[model samples]
Target: KVQESARVSGILHDIGKLVLLEFPDFFKKAKLNKQGRITQDSEYAVLGTSHSEIGGYLLGMWGLPNEIVEAITFHHRPSIQISTKPDLLTVLHTANGLANMCLMEMESDFGTYLDMKYLDAIGVSGYLDEWLSITHQVLDNTDNDQVQT
Candidate 1:
């Protein structure tokens, strides 16, 4: 299923965080001081590299497909990816944004770094309201299921 595939992509998109966690000292030092910019730029400012790049590099080294590596590498900045149509990168980015929105106050910036131009460029901006609605319903269901359990 496309949804299940996208969910897996979403899970792996942030595998960069695991790379960051591998280097606790470096991760501690890398903080995004900038207000409006995305995390990658801030990470570059602090550690001279970004978690996404590191994750991509590691995954590539392990012989993962280039497309998968590319998606993970550009998860935070999917707008920069060079492609004519929407692909896994677009899905991962939108899913990342939707999940963040569902997190509400639990996530910083509340998915603020989401680029409308990117979604517009990818031709998915028109469905954002629908995405949000579906995401919220899914989150609500998850919460209710957890409470019941």
Candidate 2:
């Protein structure tokens, strides 16, 4: 069940971006920072909200599991969570950080940063190297044609 939750949460974590796309000026108003990075503060400054909140609210309204909603809501800031136990939220957050590192070659301004404190609290901080290696192995196995340039 935890694995399933992680999968679903991962797939829907960015669903709010789809809704944001409806706003014609979203990309324009939500300007990237001087480093060409899109931070949560920048998103809030322009749109008055962040995709995490938007996605979490949507999932909550749909009556999905609270854990899933919480995971999506706090994936970018898992350290704020009160729970010290590692859960789907923790897995999603770690996976996101690893994915960002692996896709560093791509011009994506995802702005995902791993919460080292949270990882340490959850007793997984030491697994980062192993996780990164696995992520690279998976990426290597992916078909080049299916991978976007």
Best by TM-score: 2
TM-score of 1: 0.77
Q: Please write out the lDDT profile of model 2 over residues 42-94, one tens digit for every residue.
A: 77898898888899999999999999999999888888888768888988888
TM-score of each: 0.77, 0.85
- Candidate-wise lDDT, in order: 0.69, 0.79
lDDT of 1: 0.69
- Candidate 2's error at 53, in angstroms? 1.2
Q: On a 0 to 1 TM-score scale, where does candidate 2 land against the true structure?
A: 0.85
Query: Model 2: which residue pairs collide?
Result: none
The lDDT of model 2 is 0.79
The residue ranges of model 1 lying beyond 4 angstroms of the native Cα positions read 1-7, 32-38, 105-111, 143-149
lDDT of 1 at 120: 82
